[model samples]
Target: MTLRSKPYHWLYAFVLIALSAFSVQSVAETSMEQTGELQLWHKISLIFDGPETSERADYNPFIHYRLNIIFTHPATGDRFVIPGYFAADGNAANTGAESGNKWVAHFSPNHTGLWKWQASFRKNRFVAVSAKVDAGVSGGFMDGQQGQFTVSESNKELPDFRAAGRLQYVNEPYLKFAQSQTYFIKAGPDAPENFLAYQDFDGTFHNDGHKDDLVKTWEPHLTDWKKGDPTWQNGKGKAIIGALNYLNSKGLNAVSFLTMNIMGDDQNVFPYVDYNTYDRMDVSKLAQWEIVFEHAQSLGLFLHFKTQEAENQGLLDGGGTGLQRKLYYRELMARFGHHLALNWNLGEENGEWFKNHPTMPQHTNERIAMARYFYENDPYHHHLVIHNGIDYDDLFSADSHYTGASVQTHKADFSSVHTAVKRLRDWPVINGRPWAIAVDEPGDAQHSLVPDRMNPAHNNARQNGLWGALMAGGWGTEWYFGYANEHSDLTAQDYRSRDLFWDQARHSIAFFDALDVPFQRAKSHDELLSSAADYVLAVPGEFYIVYLKDASHQPTLNFKNFSGDFEINWFNPREGGEMQQGSKTTIQAKWVHKAKLNNTFNLGLPPSTPNQDWVVVVKRK
Candidate 1:
């Protein structure tokens, strides 16, 4: 049966809840119900019969109670302590319930074996905010419940996260899949950050009058949603889900969204029951979000969770990692962190880059504190990054725990994307590790990635932004729609607005994948080329990829110290296909003076388009 139909099994388990009492010890006497496809990398949920609570409870179920499960793979003794949340009615996504006695924890087992689990439910005033496991007194129901289940090998295949396992940071310039060990390159849209501010969600954001004009219906993509996908409240999520379908159809693989944007650009998105409430979560709304996230995972989409924006970065505890901020992170982790591939972005355009603004920007210490919390708490230890408004100097220090950088450049033609990516990839850290850099927002705010109709050729973007980032050792890029243009970031509801550009992005991504480029081991070596206008990524004597913005410039490669014959092939970044032979197909190494300026081998011109951008691949034959 499908995942959406598995919740029906909870009905048979709820029968045990009727026998349990509210007393602390009595709840522990009951048995825990396990639901979900019991397989590797699939979501395994453990439902408990806990104390009854509502979203509007005076005791505040979110902050007063905590549920953490210690899941262990007995064979290897590897354990993961995952956080849990209160799932109202356990079927909130379908029933739209606001209260229930069900508390649940979701876990994705990485190994196939007999896994054991134990729940540590606790309660106290503000207990959920603390990081210590023993912070509060024993919660009455299922406080010390123990259970075990079996996980078999996953039956999933390509494009599904289950097949590749978790996406992890392995101290390299790109993320790698735990199971496949294949390096990843993310290319997708970075705009419409308020993607979750849908009118169909169970929230008041549609009529909240807070940037209400920015609310998205995603109407244009509704036709993209296929039958038997997923929807909530009886077919409510078709448009948003279809939008993801459209992206995946274009060969894009990542999407960014803000979990909470209160007091930010679009205030419609948040997890709270109301706009002002921070402690109480909107259970049904979050459940609906889970349905969408699950689908994205199956479709091979990397989730970039921009937790907050510049305006709301300091909204909780004045940017300090205090009670409010900790609870917020806890809820987010408990609800969505179990996904196989995702990154926890601290904030979008965070820090004090704006002059004379009323924003309370996060200081160096506060930023480090936020990164530290995610580093210590998240079980999977997903990639952690912070977007920069001015610079990443604060996180460049030895004390910072960030694993990557979300770059935003301010160039209208996106000319700075190459330099920005190279700067971050070469930034020296105390640990001596390179950061996985992604040019998330490439161009300036005024005209970043304009609509396809307005700029059909996408000359500047394709030449400078897309190829620019890739040729500079960047892991990938996500285009940001400028607010000054049509189908702007906050106002975009159709993915087709930039249809032509998506093909260009797909061509770039497909080149590396189809050609089996060893990008993870390669570094940007523009100095090895003859012209400053061109870019080159190479592993020295093994492989080389040169991006010539103007193919007419007969730039040469420095093969002074190289000692093997190499074959050259040209790839069209504008239109992807099989690699074609260039004018000069081969170059043999020859002895030359080390101090000579002309020791480089001539790189012959492209067979056809000498004026447009082209990528040349050179490998030792």
Candidate 2:
């Protein structure tokens, strides 16, 4: 039916939500022959988990989401009628195991909406009833067998259990949150220091933050305490204090305190413990963090409260049936909304988790979504991020718009993140957001692929744009990788090498300060490489940056549509930034680069004789 333009004009408002759950098994795999190298599986999965309510936390991880699907054809019709296709689709498993005959749906009071759903298996069909999804605020539908259960209105006021933190959204307090590095140590119900032998801080914190602590790691006073002696723990605290005070003493702008329930029994510093919510002590920032943040403020350090999530080994005895993941996070953000010192660190080394248990994806999404949620809607609006392991390229997807990307990658973990950082930078998924690498390598961990005492790794990553985010308002934190020796009665001095490494890591920091770079939000360009070629980008009114794969022989070739007087600043990863003032404009200079470069310019370098790559940043003419 057609209506007159003015005759039909009217104001209207409505919301309609539809919940349809269906299960589909892998159909016969379609085999497509390839004439070239084979790449497979374009199967995309949307993730979900059981309702994230603390009450069901005993059965459901409060931080988990179901691997659910809600895909719209955008051009809806027969697509809606497909058996396994629903407005909201999901995996058969709720959290751990598959539910034979159940699904959840939500519908909003809507109009002009017509749809259909199908399933490969009959039992996977969805039954509907009214339930309240407090977070989504959409009317919920469940398997018809259970009837309907109403959430007591009073229960709405019940506290939403959450990670330790204060929410800061857009510099406002709209939510609460937590951050921690406990995945590297312990979890849930113990003091963070108990499980770890010590911390490793590089020289950047020197003078500005932990400079003195870098010196104190070698100070003989730390070993004075012994087991069964009150002084033993006191001595550990002293060591911690020395390190912390160094940050206070330095003019460093911010801090992230390690907050988690991890048990430390002296000798074995790097062990995970099991502790539930109640079993875990009140070591959360709610109590002790205030003092730390306050002290940092007096010394002028932005306080960033940190915590971690359900790292399995660190006992999570939180036996609740329902927990409001969103509200819990909001409450944390709301609690500490006003403090600039609070940043939401969802987890450390969490991005590295392999999706072995694919059905448990919602849990993964929930954890990841925790950071996404915090960064998206928090009040404090402080920097919200997740700690990605070295394999960031595989795990970090382009979702969420936040402050920056913080990573924990060592030499061992750092398998050419160029592609990963490329995705992190230019992948269609994540438009180029800021990126930072918080290196904690060459430390006390004996098995480190990149040892803790290795300081060059620190500067190398920094100068190479791994930590360039630091230059672009990107902030990085360095931890001295260490562990307590439980088997050795805590007498092991495994930290010396790394301690010395931190003392020397300052060279990188000083290098960063002197270099002219944009870490957070710099413009990037795409160009083809030929040194054997090079990838080069010429930023208008700025520098010409180039990243070469192999620097065998240097040839100044022709640049299409490029002519100007340019000064070349070749990036020497070994010696830092060196500028070679080109007297003439036909620029051909030997330079080094990190992650190589976003721009690939052709350099007439010989075939794979194998020379380390370099970057040339041509300053403004």
What are the lDDT figures for the candidates, one per model?
0.88, 0.32
Clashes of each: 1, 115
* Model 2 per-residue lDDT tens digits across residues 13-122: 11111122221111122111112111110111111122223322233221222212222322243121111111111321112221212222221101123322211111
lDDT of 1 by residue, 1-621 (tens): 754577776765565464444454575565567888999999999988888999999999999999999999989999999999999899999898999999999999999989998888889999887777898887867877788999999999989999999999998988999989888888999988888989888977778778888888899999999999899888899999999999999999999899999998889999998888888899999999999999999999999999999988888888999988898899889989999999999988888878753457987888999999998999999999999975887787887889999989999999999998888878785476578888899999988999998999998999899989988988889999999988888999888999999999999878988766577899999999989988999999888999998888788899767777889999999998889998999988665556454447877999898988899999888
> Hey, what RMSD does candidate 2 come out at?
20.1
RMSD after CA superposition, every candidate? 7.6, 20.1
Taking all chains together, the TM-score of candidate 1 against the true structure is 0.94
Error of 1 at 405 (Å): 0.6
Candidate 1 weakest lDDT stretch, 10 residues: 16-25
> Which clashing pairs does model 1 show?
24-140
